[model samples]
Target: MRIVGDGTRALNFFIDTLLVFLLAYAGFKTWNFYVMYWGYPAYNFGWFFFGILFVYYTFFELVFGRTPAKWFTYSKVVTAKGSRPALWQILVRSLVRLTIVDMFFIPFFGKPLHDKLSGTVLIEI
Candidate 1:
């Protein structure tokens, strides 16, 4: 198993972000229609978008060991020893990924805070 480099991880993040954005857009349109027709007040879209991202990353990673972006990039989340990570590890990784430091430090460090803390790594299959 080859460790995925910074470039591939960055690309995976970009693709995942784009996918989340598209999903948020669809959700926003639907919510907008409901608000317009039902006369409900507009809710905070930022929170909704964040929730979508959290669910997307956590659920997919837990279920498949990778998100859609990771799948396309031929990368996967694995334990430091190159085995499939446990559920708790995946959860920790996903939650840690939401932090600001993880976002900023990942590109330069090649491993995000999430991966380090969870004892997991991203590997190119």
Candidate 2:
């Protein structure tokens, strides 16, 4: 498998971020409906959005070894030995993604903090 470049990584980030936003919007709508139905006060979804972001990556990567963005980019996450990463690695990756500026590390650090901390790499299929 070939390691992807920054361009592919950027594409993946864009697509994934879009998807996450859409998901959060849908979730907010549904939640608002239920809250109104129960006559409860409206609430902000900032924390909920973060939760969705974490779950999105964790669920997709844990189950399929990639996110929808990764699938579209023809890439998958793998360990240093070129195998599927373990559950712990996927979780670590997802958690690190919530840091908000982890992507900034790519230029100077080569890989993002998520990839380094998780011991995972994105490889082209």
Candidate 3:
């Protein structure tokens, strides 16, 4: 196994972000349709989007150790010793994904801040 390169990791992030955006868009449109039909005020989608993303990442990582993007990229999350990360580690990794700085550091440092904080790394399979 090898640690995935920065470029591959960035691409994975882009793909995941796109997926999340698509899901959020669908949710927003559905909610708006219902709101209009019921004559209720339109609700902001930002929180809903974030909540979906949080659950999406956390759930997938905990169960699969990777997201769809990672699967497509042939990469997966693992502990420092190269074993599957524990549930708590997966949770930490997922939660830290919400921090913008974690992703921003990836281009410059090769690894994201969340990986360090969670004691996990992205490995090419």
Top-scoring candidate (lDDT): 2
Supply candidate 3's per-residue lDDT for 54: 89
| Candidate maximizing TM-score | 2
lDDT tens per residue, model 2, 1-125: 78999999999999998999999989888889989898767778886688899999999999999889999999999998999999999999999999978988887779999998888899999
Q: How displaced is residue 44 in candidate 2, in Å? A: 1.5
Model 1 Cα shift for residue 100 (angstroms) = 2.1
**Per-residue lDDT of model 3, residues 1-125, tens digit only:** 69988789879989998999889889989889989898767879886677778888888888898999999999999899999899888878877877777777766656788888888889988
Question: Stretches of candidate 1 above 4 Å error?
Answer: 107-110
State each candidate's clash count.
Answer: 0, 0, 0
Q: lDDT of all the models against the reference?
A: 0.85, 0.91, 0.85
lDDT, model 2 = 0.91
lDDT of 1: 0.85
Lowest-sum lDDT 10-residue window in model 2: 39-48
